[model samples]
Target chain A: MSRQALAELFSRCRAENRAALLPYMTAGLPDPEGSVRLFVAMAEAGADGFEVGIPYADPLMDGPVIQAAGDRALAAGSGVEVALDILEQVVAETGRPSVVMTYVNPVLRMGPEVFAQRLSQAGASGAIIADLPVDEALPFASALDRHGMGLVLFVAPTTTEARLENVVQASPPFVYGVAELGVTGERDMASSHIGSLVARVRKHSEVPVVAGVGIATPDQARSAAAAADGVIVGSALVRRVMEADTVDAAEDALRVAVGELADAIRRD
Target chain B: MRLDRPDNQGRFAEYGGQFAPETLMPALEELETEFAKAWDDPGFHNELNKLLADFVGRPTPVYRAERLSDQLGIDLYLKREDLAHTGAHKINNTMGQALLTKRMGKNRVIAETGAGQHGVATATACALLGQECVVYMGEKDIERQALNVQRMRMLGTEVRPVTSGAGTLKDAVSAAMRDWVATVDTTHYIIGSVVGPHPFPWMVRELQKVIGEELQEQMDGSQRPHPDVIVACVGGGSNAMGIFYPYVGSDVRLVGVEAAGYGLETGEHGASLVAGSPGVIHGSMTYLLQDVQGQILEAHSISAGLDYPGVGPEHAYFKDRQLVEYTSITDEEAVEAVNLLASVEGIIPALETAHALAWIAKEADSLRGQTVALNLSGRGDKDVQQIIDLVDADE
Candidate 1:
């Protein structure tokens, strides 16, 4: 049911001939309740969907912006339960397809079936487990499948054609294309290699491919969006929320920041 | 190879799978292929063995601890890895990996260090091999292990201090992973222990298996051959794995000692094998010190090298299969063993090595009349300052 909602949103974006603007936020950032408000504001600001990050002590894939946010959220007692609460609220209030981004350990710690059941219960569309590659995702993907949820897999420019075919065969909710060879952070421009990687993904399946990592500015988002079906702007937006002194300040900034990104990727 | 691999996907009986990000999967696969090819190649063997002999001082003597052994009514033999070029067993792995890096056509090297022994060894290899090298060390370790830190820098390597998450070994591992993700094209991360994602645990053990191979050759023909038990300290467990690999299926007992810090009771210990549950850390499934919510807890030890929250996945496999015995030694006991070794044997040992000695001392009663071999993984010079500070505190 949750994956169906995300599929419909993707179809709508495709019909409009525009890339969907999917913004990411670390759950329980300032606090649990405040993060729900932040997601609500982002949805109101025209984000097509949300990717809520679960706080983990060790985020090897994240840069400073998201790392600091995760550390703060964890310190604020944002464990899986708290993040799920925030995910449930964001999905209920925003009425958009949302997912959780986490490392592999927490899911394994909770046991995949239980974790997936709780994620679905929280109204999540799917999950993007950063360290969980397709090769080691059998149990997790099957567990998520039982809950009618999708497992999103990543494809980097470094990924070979044969491996990309294998990833597409997993039939993820959507394919996450890593924009560059680095952790999640803002870059001056969209990575040049993303276009080829998106093209590779397009050849295998009709599944929507989203470009993420280091996409900060409107033009960068537009370029990344051009290469794929959607663009995921995380660190750029996360940096705003991180630097804001108050939730009110962050909400207003996100409204404007997400608006510019939406406008840049939106078709008439 | 006496040390078996973790299947095709790198899972060693539910432990030691490649749980890294998607980007690193190809690199891991590539490394696995390269490592196998290198291992099979006679040229690679000749070069590695030659360097092991000429530069790093191969076949470090296995000396009998006559005085200490007589005190306990047991024969204690020490595999003096301390006598190696870098003053630790770490060189055995680094020299091999640095050469492997060159063969892979990667000119840059990155590594993470705990007590700085691995960093010094890695840096020395990169310097000798003419590769650009960088090492991430915990800020806490850099403070505690100042001398080895200086040696690493003097070897012309960049020493980056990781201040995140207690600024210890695990955090340093995370920092090194972050760097490798971006620089993987031209660089190779020389993980310092039998940890991390696959090819690493298997490959490091293979490189270090030389210790066991040498021991078998030296002792198998002698009258005083076939020890009743073998003991070594385990952090990420390379040194222990090194000396324990050959005698795995034999009747001889294999024991790995961990640091108990203040004591397991105080919850300030690094005894992951005994105290931790199965979980993933540094990209592989292993026994880890974590809260129920899955947040990693800080591991404490007087020895900087053993101050880690996780043990090697291979060690986890061994523990589960009952192929080896896992034990712990407290900080107080380790200190006492250090004093005992210095007084009785005139051989100052690394704090990491003291854990194994302390275990022997504790089990002296049971081990009486039995012959035991312990891998003295490193010398005490790097830890002498810390020991001196402790003595001064007592004074």
Candidate 2:
């Protein structure tokens, strides 16, 4: 999808009074087929967007749930290429918007230009390279722009205003505001300074700002949606998949969580 | 003068090369120019020498190991690097680099530590210079060397325990490198040894040459023209290179001993030179103990200082060029050497440096009438309690 397409999608989510349900799933967790089916199922179950995680040996900013999923995916011999292929199949099946979530090394290894081109060809809407800072985002951003793909940047609570402005200016689509200092997990969102963070980011950028990182419960998602244009829940969806008794159970649980979160955010 | 030669490709004897990310190319180039100019400036050398003597307590004695030499049937002269302040030859490089950081107008220093010797040395320099210091140590190392961690903290250094990937020295170095790349504007990564991309190995060597320089001066003054052999342990090979570089042109045969935790054949060892193949690791071309698929393997050694999977690039170059003969000493042998030195010489050498002394003891009979000088790299006070525990366990 083009940057314009992603922007329109974000605007539509805002207009419809619904928080964006961005479900995250490791590429080959459970198995490759199960991962693809889960992706399609989540999309069909009303996920506005999906974050397809590429397994790596070291996931610095990930908690135990995501880390274990990544470990299982890696043990199944899944890598960036595998993740992209699975994403291609999911998009082909459901025509849902998706973002590739990965670290910088794999992208660097794949060559930024080629990676962007492949993602664009495979119908991936955008990407969020977790480790790439705003100061070093130009090359990757330019590559994504070259392929008509969006580069989503993360704005943490600790991020300085100057850095946030730089990230907003460099990145396309929208800025993802990390609501807390810790990694992704089903964290207690009551203490998250989500409102002020979204307000600060809104003051600096004309681009849409979505808040993530600990929006676990439907109540938390609704609360986050009240202050931001979008609420991206990842760790909760990943946790559901991990705790599922079977692949079908995982898909069913993810659909139920997304439907409930989407309904809760839309209600108000 | 062929002053531009070493800078041609960031090399020291065709081993050290700038195998770093393109982002660091500019910084490496800048460091190379500054270090080159600093090396020729007599003022810089004089100031460094003064600090080494007054502050760091240099010209650390050359004691004759009379009892051990008599027992082994050879004359052993110990170049006492252990007497240096902060307890290891690591300080020689840190102090020089810290001063260079000041000269370059940088106020923050970052360093990576394995056994925390370098952390202590860097912390000492930062405290002395009043510069803000940050040290990255693996969580495992922080636990193993808690006292050294506390020592670093006492010296006012911020010690960050890295919990990434195996959480060892290699990962710590990786984290430090990442930090340097991100914060290169005000930070000078005082790489703890003769490693890293470029200019670092050469710069560290230039600083550590004091070891060999003093040994030469002291040896000449004592009527011993030169040693028949010079021995030192190799971890990242800083101490060994520090004592061997000045004697390169001389006929003194250099012997580098590595940690053979169990034995070389058991594959449970840190004898990188003997068991490793030349591969690119941590930015420089070096001998690394990697598996069949090129994954860097975890090293095992009783001596924390000697427990690295890769040796310095300079040591790789030396080994390949046949300038130094590499050997291994078992943990059992090193422990015995520590006990022997404490009993005979009344000096306890660091577990790391004891590897060299152990090798010398084992090979002393072959060099019967020859005078061999060993780099007593650090005091064993840090390892005393650990040794006591090991002894008690053995009993």
Candidate 3:
């Protein structure tokens, strides 16, 4: 059911002639209620899909903003179950396709089979696990597939053309193309390297390839959407929530920001 | 044992693999290919062996500690790795990896350090090989190992202090991994211990096998050729694996001593193999000191080098297969062992090595009739200040 939901989401994006507006949300960022509240606002403001981050203890790939958000989430006593609960609540409210983003350790600790089962039960369309390269990702991918959830894989700027097939062969819902060379953070338009990486990924896979890691503003999102099927904005959205004074302020800020991104990604 | 492990997928019975970001997957592949080519090449071996012998001072003797032996009523043989260049067994791996960095055509080297011995050795090797070197150390480790920090700086290497997640060895490893994720194209991360992603645990162990290999050659002339037992400290288990890998299936019993900081009950120790459960850390699945939610716990020890939450994957394999007996010693006991070795033989052992000596000292009476070989992995000159403070506190 969840895998079908994800496929339907991509179909919807194509029919609407707009790139998927997948806004990354860190679950339980100051608190669980606030995280859900903000996601509800993002969904209302035209977020086509959601990437829900389950805060981890050590987020090596994440920059300072997402790292701080995760740190606060963990400090508030949120674990895998709590994050899954948040996912359930978001899906219930939004009724939109959403994927859980996590580092591999938490899923491994939860036991991959049980982890996949729980996420599927929580109504997660798929999962994006950071730090799990395709070399060691087969078992986890199979586990998710067995549970009827899409497994998202990454194709970084550093990934060469020769190595593109193995990742594409996995047939992820979307190939997460890391636009930048460094950890996840905001970057300027001075370096727009997403197109080349997206082009390389498209050579092997027909599925929509979404560029992430370096994108921030609506302008960057539109420019990135021009090169790829979609864009995943993480640190930029996270910084807004982290720097906000109250829940209302954060929700309003996210609603406006996601709305701008959605407008910018509209191809027609 | 036959000792062919990590398989092709880099797993040692479900432990160890490329648990890194996609950015470094190609880099790991490149490294594995280059490392295999270098391993099979005689020219690579010729250069590395020459550097090991002349630059890093290899083939350090196995000195029989007569006085300590008399006290223990056992023939105690110390593999004097303290005599090696840079005052620890770390130089062996550093020289080999530095050469690999050159062989791979990467001119930059990045590493993480705890006691800073590996940092100093890496800096020295990079200086010799004309490779730019950078070392990530925990903020707390930088404070404790001040002398080693200065030594790294003096060797013309940049020592970056990591402040995240308890500011210790585990954090330093994460910081270095993050750096490698960004700059992997021109940079070859020289992981200090046998604890990182695949090829590392295998590569480091292969490079360091000289310790056990030399012991095999040196003890051949003795009446009891192979010692009844071999002991080495297990901070990430490089030194222990170095000496133990050769004797995996041999009659010689292998024991790895870990640092049990305040004690197991206090929940403050670096005894990952002894007290930890299996989890992923620093790009490899291994025994880790992590909470139920897989959040890494802060590991404590007076010895900065041993203050880590994860052990090498091979050590985890040995633990599961019952190939080696893993034990722990408290900081107080390790300090006493340091004083004991300095007083008995006038040899100051590093706090990391003292953990092994402390274990051997405690078990000496039980193994009275046998020969025990302990890898004295490092000297204590770098730890003199902390020792003085500890002794003064005792007085």
The model with the greatest TM-score is 1
In terms of lDDT, the poorest run of 10 residues in model 3 chain B is B218-227
Tens-place lDDT per residue, model 3, A170-213, is 88888888888878888876236777877787676678888888
Per-prediction DockQ: 0.81, 0.07, 0.77
Q: In what order do the candidates fall by lDDT, top score first?
A: 1, 3, 2
Q: List the residue pairs that clash in candidate 1.
A: none
Local distance difference test values of all predictions, in order: 0.91, 0.80, 0.88
Model 1 agreement with the true structure over B2-46: per-residue lDDT tens digits = 347779888778889988888888998899999999999999999
Rank candidates, DockQ, best first: 1, 3, 2
Q: What tens digits encode model 2's per-residue C-alpha lDDT throughout A1-268?
A: 5566667777788778765667677888778878898888887777777788888655545666786787678777687778889988877887677888887656755678989998998888889877665544677888998888878877766566666677777756778777655566787544267778778877867677777777788888888877777777777888888888899999899889888887867735
Residue B113's lDDT in candidate 2: 93
A14 Cα displacement, candidate 3 (Å): 2.2
Per-residue lDDT of candidate 3, residues B1-395 (tens digit): 42565789888877888888899888988888888899999999999998888877789988999899999899999999999999999999999999999878899999999999999999999999889999999999998889999999999999999988788888888888889888998999999889888879989998899999999998875644568899999999899999999889877899999999999889999999999999888889999998887777889999999999999999998899899999999999999999999999999999999999999989888989788999999999989998887778889
Candidates 1 and 2 compared: the better one by TM-score is 1
CA displacement after TM-score superposition, residue A186 of candidate 3 (Å): 1.5
Residue-level error in angstroms, candidate 2, position B46: 2.7
Q: How well is candidate 2 docked (DockQ)?
A: 0.07
**Predicted structure 3: lDDT:** 0.88
Stretches of candidate 2 exceeding 4 Å from the true structure = A1-268, B1-7, B11-15, B19-25
